[model samples]
Structure formats: C-alpha cells, structure tokens
Target: MINEVTRALVAHLHSRTPDLGSWVVVHSLSAADAAPAKDKLALCLLAVDEHDHLRNSPPVEVAGRLQRAPMQLRLSYLVTYFGPHDEAMARLTRVIAVFHTTPVLGQDELPLTLGEQVERVTVRLRNTTADERNQVWSVLGRPGRLALFYTVDVAPVRLLPGLDGDGRVLAHRIDLAGTP
Candidate 1:
C-alpha cells in the first residue's frame, strides 16, 4: 500500500510536468547514491505509523464471516534531490506546486494496488526541527542538501479472516449492585 501511494504520486508528478521527465522515483538513498542519475528526485520512505483515526474500525463481513478491520497506517517520505542545484531546485518548486494543487489522491487517482478498503490517501508537508532533521539525515547516512518532507495518510493493511466465532451478543448477564 505504501508503494502504491508513492507510485501514484510519481505518476501524478509525471503527468503534471512532462518536462520534468521520469526523474521522480522511489528508491533508497544508500542504494541510489552508488549509481546516481544526473537529474532525479528520490522519494524515500522515511517512516510509518499506525493511524489513530480508525482505532476501532467496524468489523467487515466477508463470505458471511465478520473479519477484523484492516489496520490503518500513515507513511512518511523524503523527496531528496540529486544533480545540479539550480535545475533541481526549479523542479522541486514545480513538485511543490503540483502537490499544493492536489494534496489528496482518491480512488479515481490511485492505482488498484491500494486495498479496496482504502478510499483515499492524503499528502502533506511535515515540519521538523533542525535537530530532528539532522537525526533523520544521520540515520540515512547522507549529508543534508535539500529535501522535501511529506506524510501520506491512511493505508489499510488487511488482516487474516476466521474470527473465533459468529460475532454476536450471545447473552446478557445482569447483576444487581448488592448481589455477589
């Protein structure tokens, strides 16, 4: 699902600016750094966390059996520029503009890779302190140049079926306050 979101963003970027070419990609800095391209921007997965919005999602009925709700996740990515500073910055500006215009990707925009439960994905810029930024760069083993931080919302991870039993209120036991 994470890859699906990134892929959707890549396609969106390509569609918005054909002049930018197909330089928008999803790859690790450590891997790409070895064989870097002349003009490219890598959208690297930075982190992932559970989305609290659907903490208590309703059970889904599939094949007459109620299945546990899919786990919702939020993903973070860093758009790092590689190549000449001037041209890269110009392209990054366009990238910002594109995202600014369309920050959310819905079922109409997203590929089929996303689960049926996931209706849409939200993208937004994430603000971080200098120390936090330094920490992230240090972990990635790259000297900070220029990067765009973004967080994509709500990727559903489907869990296995076969819940213990038919989900129902079998019985209601009522106890009086004075009764043991």
Candidate 2:
C-alpha cells in the first residue's frame, strides 16, 4: 500500500509539473549513489509513520456492520532536484508551488489503483527541526542536500470485520398502559 501511494504521488507530480520533464525516480536514499544526471529529479521515501491523532480511532460502522478502522499514515519523502544549482532551485520552487496549489489529491486525481483503495490524500509541507532533519539524513547514511520534506496523509488503508453477524434494529415498541 505504501509503495502504491508513493507511485501515485510520483505520477501526480509528473502530471502537475510537466515542465520538469520525465525525471522522477523513486528509490531509497543513499549517500554513495551518484547524483542524478542533469535534467533528473528523485523522490526518496524517507519514512512512514502513523498519524498520532487518529491512531486510536474506534471501529468504523458500515452498513450495520462494524469494521476495524484503517491505519492512518503520514508518509515522508525527500524531494531532490539534481542539476545546476540555479536550475535545481527553480525546479524545486515549482515543485513547492504545485503542491501548494493542489494540497489535496482527490479521488479523481488519484491513480486508478489508489482511487479504488483511498478516498483522498492530503499533502503538506512538513516543518522539521534541523536536528530532526539531520537525524533523518543520518539514518539514511547520507548527507542532506537541497531537498524539501513533504508528508502525505493516507487514511484508512485497511478494514477488518469487527463482528461476524449483522446488527439490525427490527422493531420499535411503545408502552401506553398508563394512558389506557
């Protein structure tokens, strides 16, 4: 599911920023890896963490049946532009602008596979402290470069049946003995 989300996001970025051309690469962050060639960009999924606020949500009710709520996740990514510093900055700025304009990826904008699985996704720029940012890069064994951190919230990724049988209210009864 995470992979699917990443791919869908990459596709969305491609469509939204056609001026950048075909230069989006999805892979793990590696310091040893050579920089992306000119005219290329990379999207490295740095981490996937649960959204703390929704971690303890109650089971969802659907069609008279209770089902376990899906896991709400916040996916982090390092958007890197590899090229001349000036051009790279330009591309990065455009990337920021695009996300700002379309903060939410609606069901229609999602890839077919993702659209079926998720109702919508919210993208936001994450403000990480220098220490946190350094830690992330350290974990990847890479030195941080000119990159932006963005988080995508994917809610309710899976659903589990809460009970076996359907719950129904068959009838209503009223007591009028006193009135009689």
Candidate 3:
C-alpha cells in the first residue's frame, strides 16, 4: 500500500508540473497517532514565494519637504501596495495550510488496528508555522485536493493506544537554538 501511495503521488506531481518545470519527491516514517487511510496517505509540500506576478509589490517611498520662514526640512513618504507575486504567495500559503490539516481516508498499506477494532485513519497538522498552518486549515474545511508548490518531508511513526505501550514518538519539537 505504501508503494502504491508513493506511485500515485508521483503520478499526481508529474501531471501538475509542466515539461519545463519539475518537482522533487520525498518520504519518511515517524510515530503517529493514526495510520494513513486505505487509499490516501498524508503528504506535505513546501514552497517559496517566487511567482513574479504575485510578489511584485514592494514598499515604495517618495521625497517630501517642509519649509518654514527660516528652516527647511525633508522627509520620506511611505507607500504600501500588493503586486502579482504577493497575491500568488498568499494563495500558495493558504493552499498548503488546508492540505496539512485536512484528513482524507481511503486504502493504505499501513496496518492500523487499535485494540480489537479497525481504527479509522486521519491526517492532522501536528505543528507548523502559523501562517502556513492556517492556510491548510482553511482549505481542509473545503473539498478537493489543494493546488500549490511545496517541499515535502516524509517520516514513519508508530501510534500507541496507551502510554504503557512501547511505541515511541519519533518526532519531537525542537527549539531554534537546537535545544529539544
């Protein structure tokens, strides 16, 4: 099932990227609370705001001057605006947020059984940047696969039903300073 999932994702990516463009594929396994759905697997894609159309907007400044009877002063004027690149960046960010938080269930290779029952699978965004995370949430609340550019990191995880079990969480929060 994992192999099939990987193939499906690769196919999907191939369809999205044009002949001149490209995308890299990645995979990982870590401790998780739930297994991937029968047909769908959790995925993450990272992207930068490189679209020129949406990111063209930059702060602008103009020269200004004030004059009094005996003194003259000059100051800079400030302007805030949005360009094509900015819009694209914002839209891409929103798309990523939705994909990370939304749970899609189907067929999967991972054997997921909780106690005696066949547990339902769900995908969740454990931790992420605020802006990127919120965008994923918004899209998750809606329907359909999100469209955007993103970098992906995959990890396998074991989900334990109880604290007494031996399954350990492989992913942990770390500070920017490198402290765990």
Model 1 TM-score?
0.81
Residue 96 lDDT in model 3? Answer: 44
What tens-digit string does per-residue lDDT give for candidate 1 at 1-180? Answer: 677777888898899899767878777776336635768888888888888787788887766666666778888888877888997788789888988999987887877656365778888988978888888888878788688888888757776555463354558999878966
Tens digits of per-residue lDDT for model 3, 6-105:
3444444344434413332332212232332322223433232222332323322222322111111111111111224554355345334443543333
**Highest lDDT model number:** 2
**Model 3 residue 59 distance off true place after TM-score fit, in angstroms:** 62
Q: Put the candidates in lDDT order, highest first.
A: 2, 1, 3
Estimate the TM-score of every prediction: 0.81, 0.82, 0.21
Give candidate 1's error at residue 172 in angstroms.
Answer: 9.1
Number of backbone collisions per candidate: 0, 0, 32
Candidate 3 overall lDDT versus native: 0.32
Model 3 ranges with Cα > 4 A deviation: 27-126, 129-180
Cα lDDT listed for each candidate: 0.78, 0.80, 0.32
RMSD of 1: 3.7
* lDDT: the better of candidates 1 and 2: 2
Candidate 2 lands at a TM-score of 0.82
